[model samples]
Target: MEAVSYSGLRKNLKHYLQQVNDDATTLLVTNRDNDDTAVVMSKRDYDSMTETLRIMSNPTLIDKIRRGKTQIAKGKTKQHELIEPDD
Candidate 1:
């Protein structure tokens, strides 16, 4: 995460935006008043976060994931060969 003042962000908006996108990082923009503070992040990161949140909100899916993990820990998993598609 990187922090920059409002004026500083405005001065180097392009640079800061590029850094955030390339690094997949969040940027904290601070203003004179705390109420105006904001966070900037790449769209990809934002979408991934939302997807994770959505999955976490489902109880059944979480239970299934936990069961799968438990099975792996118990060495009850099976390995399957990958299937290739015909051209």
Candidate 2:
């Protein structure tokens, strides 16, 4: 793992990309507000993170619609639905 300033990353974008392509290398981007840092890793690691995120994201929309219908059938929902404003 290597830590570089934000300016360094911007200046050596190609070099940083090359390191990112190396599976063993990880980069830390620094010099942002509140001392926050961002990590850059190989595509394999990025894909693994994406898959984990997909698994973690919930099916909230389907659950909400099912609950709404059940509530309506039970007379627990309000009769009036709010209309959205048109742009």
Candidate 3:
């Protein structure tokens, strides 16, 4: 993550956008008024984070994931088809 003042963001919008696009680095914009802050990131990173947050927000799904991980670690997983295809 990189921090830059709002004024700096306006002054160098192109350079900052390019860096964010090319390196997937998050940019934090700070402002003196009302202690406001904003974030800039690539669409891919933003989508991935949103999806992760969505998953984490579901208690049942999270528990299932944890249980699956533990089962894999314990070699308790069985080979099975996750989906069925019909002719």
Candidate 4:
């Protein structure tokens, strides 16, 4: 994440917009008078983050993810090809 003042962002809006889109960078806009702040990020990245949050909110899925990480750390994982189902 990159931090920039409101004025700075407005001054270089085009450049920062490119950074957010191309580099998948997040921008934190800060204000002087107030504690208000804003974040800017790509739509794709935002969607991905929301999806991850949705998955994490499920207790069953969270447990499974934790177990998988433990198994990986214990070197109990195997290499296998993932076969997708035909539509």
Candidate 5:
């Protein structure tokens, strides 16, 4: 992550945006005023983070994942045929 002042970000908005997209990094736009901070991130990163949050919010899904991992560790696994969806 990188921190830049609000004015600085405004001055070099294009460069900052390109950097965020190209480097897959986040930018923290800081303001002198209280609690006016903003964050800039690539869409891909944002989507990934949101998806992770959604998954983490589901306890049943997380428990299933943990159980799957434990099953793999214990060598209790089976392979199945892939089911392709009709186009």
Candidate 6:
């Protein structure tokens, strides 16, 4: 993690981005008006985070997770429930 003022980021945006890509570094920008701002990885990280959120949002997955908990409570299933295909 690194801290830089807003002006510093604006002045050396390219350099900061280089650091981000090369080292997976984070820059925290601070200002009097805005407490903190972040500059992070590019679309790769954005797409990955988006996909993760999508998968987590699936209702079927949510149901399976809840059912898994129930099965565990009742000692009715092992590590893998292997929920068969609905079809």
Candidate 4 global lDDT: 0.94
**Comparing 1 and 4 on lDDT, the stronger one:** 1
Model 1 per-residue lDDT tens digits across residues 1-87:
789999999999999999999999999999999999999999999999999999999999999999999999999999999999998
Write candidate 5's Cα lDDT for 1-87 as tens digits. Answer: 799999999999999999999999999999997599999999999999999999999999999999999999999999999999999
Q: For candidate 6, lDDT tens digit of each residue in 1-87?
A: 788888988999899888877776667777766746655675666687888798789989888888989998998964656889998
Residue-level lDDT tens digits of model 4 in 1-87 = 889999999999999999999999899999985668999999989999999999989999999999999999999999999999999
- Model 2 TM-score on a 0 to 1 scale: 0.49
TM-score for each of the candidates: 0.90, 0.49, 0.74, 0.68, 0.83, 0.56
Evaluation by TM-score, superior candidate among 2 and 4: 4
For model 3 the local lDDT of residue 75 reads: 100
lDDT of 3: 0.94
Model 5 misplaced stretches (Cα beyond 4 Å): 79-87
| TM-score of candidate 4 on Cα atoms, chains taken together | 0.68
lDDT of each: 0.97, 0.82, 0.94, 0.94, 0.97, 0.79
RMSD to true structure for each model, in Å: 1.2, 12.1, 3.4, 3.1, 2.0, 6.6
Q: Which clashing pairs does model 5 show? A: none
Q: Model 1 misses residue 25 by how many Å?
A: 1.4
Clashing pairs in 2: none
Over 4 Å off in model 6, which ranges?
61-87
lDDT per residue (tens digit) for residues 1-87 in model 3: 899999999999999999998998999999997568999998999999999999999999999999999999999988987787887
TM-score computed on alpha carbons, candidate 6: 0.56
